[model samples]
Target: MRGTPLRGAIYGLLAAAIWGGMYVVSDVVLKVIPPFTLLTIRLILGAVVLLVIRWRTA
Candidate 1:
């Protein structure tokens, strides 16, 4: 699309923000929870969030 540059910039910023949040939250959770369990929780949470977004758009 013609908006590729703008799209890329927005996605890059979004990725940075997401990873920053991920690091903070995982650090907190890892103090008590195991890595695998944390991963499952993160993945499921991401999936549910994405599905909700998709449903709204569609």
Candidate 2:
């Protein structure tokens, strides 16, 4: 597909940034949120994000 490389690079960068920030964010968030509750919230948000991306691509 056209611009596939550019899209891939952008996605890679975004993933990397998220991964890098996750630890810092989680540390502060965990103080306010319980572990399991935080996990569930993350899972739900991730699923919603993936579904939106899939729907947009399709």
Candidate 3:
């Protein structure tokens, strides 16, 4: 029970960090890749991650 809050807080911080860094990373990446190409790559990567998580859980 005591570990639950700490785990949640850690997850929250990680989420925040990724969310914050995304804009900066995207800005730099966009200089090299086209906007649509980047968007497509992000979408594909997100889908693959989600699928892997689901597969592992199942």
Per-prediction RMSD in angstroms? 3.3, 2.1, 1.8
Better of 1 and 3 by lDDT: 3
TM-score of each model, in listed order: 0.57, 0.71, 0.85
Higher-scoring candidate on lDDT, 2 or 3: 2
Task: Report the candidate with higher TM-score, 1 versus 2.
Answer: 2
Which of the two candidates, 2 or 3, achieves a greater TM-score against the reference?
Answer: 3
> What do the candidate models score in CA lDDT, each in turn?
0.91, 0.96, 0.95
TM-score between model 1 and native: 0.57
The backbone clash count of each candidate, in order, is 0, 0, 0
- Give the alpha carbon lDDT tens digit for every residue of 1-58 in model 2: 5669889999999999999999999999999999999999989999999999999999
Off by over 4 Å in 3: 1-3
lDDT of 3 by residue, 1-58 (tens): 5579889999999999999999999889999999999889989999999999999999
Off by over 4 Å in 2: 53-58
The pairs that clash in candidate 3 are none
Largest lDDT belongs to which candidate? 2
Ranked candidates (TM-score, high to low): 3, 2, 1
Score residue 50 of candidate 1 by CA lDDT: 100
